[model samples]
Target: MAEEKSNKKTNIGEVVSDKMDKTVVVAVERKTQHSLYKRVIKRTSKFKAHDENNECNEGDIVKIVETRPISKQKSWKVEEIIRKAK
Candidate 1:
């Protein structure tokens, strides 16, 4: 059997249900170590992404990635809409 390969990437985020039609909210978190202080810090960002199928709901964690512009500043699209909100 041939092994299928995918060059896709995934990002985790929080699902926010709003009146924006087929869109969900995603949060990206990053941790960096301070070079001078030698300490670690965390940074997070929330993004509004498009989910046409509504497969993901509020509080659901999902994976997304950079893609062609679906809309203004919407180059980041959902790669996989997670079924469970973990």
Candidate 2:
């Protein structure tokens, strides 16, 4: 039987930096319970995403999809802008 390929992974986060050309850093924050302490903790992970048109700005909420590596540190691409920054 042939298996269907699933779509690439995607993440939603707020854009933290847009100083690089065609690239932006997105910070995704999540809350998780400590493994043993049973306490809730907040964690943040940053990812570099490619923006073809350089449309992303700092503080914008964006969706990013995993893609083939476009650079040394970029394996994600900007999929859409979920919300505009105030």
Computed on alpha carbons, the lDDT of every model, listed in order, comes to: 0.73, 0.97
* Cand. 2 Cα-lDDT: 0.97
In the range 47-68, model 2's lDDT, one tens digit per residue, is 9999999999999999999999
- Whole-structure CA lDDT of model 1: 0.73
Which candidate leads the pack in TM-score? 2
What local lDDT score does residue 68 receive in model 1, on the 0 to 100 scale?
64
1-86 per-residue lDDT for model 1 (tens digits):
99987665557776665357677778788899988998999988877787777677777778887666788756666678566655
- Which structure among the candidates has the greatest lDDT? 2
Off by over 4 Å in 2: 1-5
